[model samples]
Target: MKGDDDASVVVAGVRVGSFTRDSFVDRVLTMARGDSTRVAVGVNAHVCNLARTDARLREALSTSTTYADGQSVVWAARLLGGHLPERLATTDIAEPILRAAAAEGLPVYFLGAAEGVAERAAELLRDRIPGLRLRTHHGYISEGDVSLVLDEIAAHGTRILFVGMGDPAQQYWVENHRDRLPAAVLTCGGLFDWLSGSNRRAPAWMITSGLEWLWRLMIEPRRLARRYIVGNPAFIAAVLRQRRHETPRRTPSGVL
Candidate 1:
């Protein structure tokens, strides 16, 4: 159900896969070849902090092949004494995923994003990744329509599904429908907007410098202020608390 040595690490009881971007794409390609179904997800500081309070989101992650999608989360893992290798940010990785699907001839479904965004993203991907078998549906989907969407994906033989509705909503939809969807599901936050050029990403310097959050905050202050300003600090506090709890070491006498 998971990739080999998936590098799954637990933070505050939520599991996150630590594979490099390349390794993740390879695993998806292999899964597609075998027609395996799984839920692929990602995490950031806000998501981690949310999981601490949101049992539903936490439970959903516990069942997924998750990744640390934010550099800040990776750094927090290190601060908590976890051996996370790097950031697996979704924006940086979506292209490689599409490329893998194109090469392997995997049928992919794009779900979520505003009206027409998913289709636009699909068109962009097909143009860039020749031979990509892509389909799309906008986020106008409602609760009553979930089963219909599942049937559509299954009937079309979708191999990989990307859901970009953001946060717990995206994760919840995939978790609830994955059983009937017949494809590996990826909870890709805002990936469509980035790919469709509806959202502008920061320069490479900002991303590498771990200030991508700042750039996003600058762009959508009203929307993301609480996530970065409040959630980031809370995540740091949780990691430091985890670190403290790990520190009651054995004495040199070899006894507790």
Candidate 2:
């Protein structure tokens, strides 16, 4: 809500914020220092498609500041006559955010990923940005246990919380608890694994070519097959449908 709602385009009924990397980070960092709590959600094709069916996801995006984290979503927006300054991939945004947190002396919390992963990532982040106030909690908790996690984070005085529990669940948690938190939150799904170096990114060439999905599929086919294989096509179809509905057909006169 703190971002440019006018610049956002409705993707499957969810307003996806179109922000450049610097602008997105600036908005979030500024919000973190505000009087009230704010949340930043990374929206991609998979997330947009998920929003169509998941009421929790829809509600989360309705209130959270979202950045375009997928190339597919950028292309889809262009086809629908919407402009995204550029792809603000969540992984690319994370380090800069951490740097800002360190500069502000804001204590940060990492919540998600497998056991030991968050601990490992906190070490890396502390090394990457000296004087960073970092904390870790692996995202293995029942709904009954979330309050304990929240209490611990509050007790630690965390100002920036990164929740990487993936998709709708992460969104749902942040939505339900943002009011209770004293921090700005981001649902950066899978970011802890990547930052910890437990999961390697695709080669730079492949990432630039937008074939990172293929690289991930090659590495974790069993896990990502459905998301990349099925979700991708579904996303494209939804985009095309939205484009047709929102854009006017040109007559032979080349005018509406």
Candidate 3:
């Protein structure tokens, strides 16, 4: 992904790329077919909150392209007077991208998730899209495993590598090894969890109404309680503060 597009929106001080779902998928697949390496990451309230305080995370985000991955982020952009096409949940976009990759006969790699989770997700994908060239590795890798994982990725001739080790860590891993990778990379937080059936997505109605976080909280309250209950308000407050310091700008579409 390239640097912020002309129409990119600053939400809570993080630049979120304005791309329709199709365009983003096309860009990623195009990058996979190219020689040079590029990275794309999804943005949500959790990521925005972290980027506000973590310089390293901010650096990772600044270098890679970003997309709106949460409804809250899309709402925040609208609240701050910017336009994003839609909320592109990483899980939703991954299927289309993989389908395209399958049609093109490009090898795709899934790296992250707990042991056997990525493999399970890969199995589901293989069933979903026949003839998808895919490979997998668990996210729990030791320092010595880095070289092995890279070798496997290279050996598999991966064109796109989806890293799902969660935020900051996944971003940092890509940042640390960007130069060594030969494929287009995307940091996908918890995508494997959903795909592997370890977590369930919200109902379509909840998702469309921007209550997916509530569903997530309902299912995994102990884990996500702080993130949603505490972090969400903090993210909203930060966006409001940012709005106070900046002037709203009219943006056009299709700049990227």
Q: Using lDDT, give the best candidate's number.
A: 3
Ranking by lDDT: 3, 2, 1
Candidate 3 lands at a TM-score of: 0.94
| CA RMSD per model (angstroms) | 5.1, 5.1, 2.2
Tens-digit lDDT track for model 3 on 1-256?
4423447887886888887888888889878988888888899999999998999998877767788999999988888888888999998999999999999999999999989999999999999898999999999999988999999999999999999988889999988888778658999988989988888889999999999989989998998999999999999999989889889763433222
lDDT of 2 at 249: 23
Q: Indicate the worst ten consecutive residues by lDDT in candidate 1.
A: 247-256
Error of 2 at 194 (Å): 0.3
Decide which is better by lDDT, 1 or 2: 2
Q: Which stretches of candidate 1 lie over 4 Å from their true place?
A: 1-7, 34-36, 247-256
Clash count for candidate 1 is 1
Per-residue C-alpha lDDT of model 2 across residues 1-256, encoded as one tens digit per residue: 4344346766655567767777777887787787788788877878987888888777777767777788877776777777767888788889998898889888889999999999998998888798899998999988898899999899878888899888888888777787787658888899998999999999999888878889989999999999999999999888778777776221111000
Q: Assess the local accuracy of residue 72 in candidate 2 as a C-alpha lDDT between 0 and 100.
A: 79
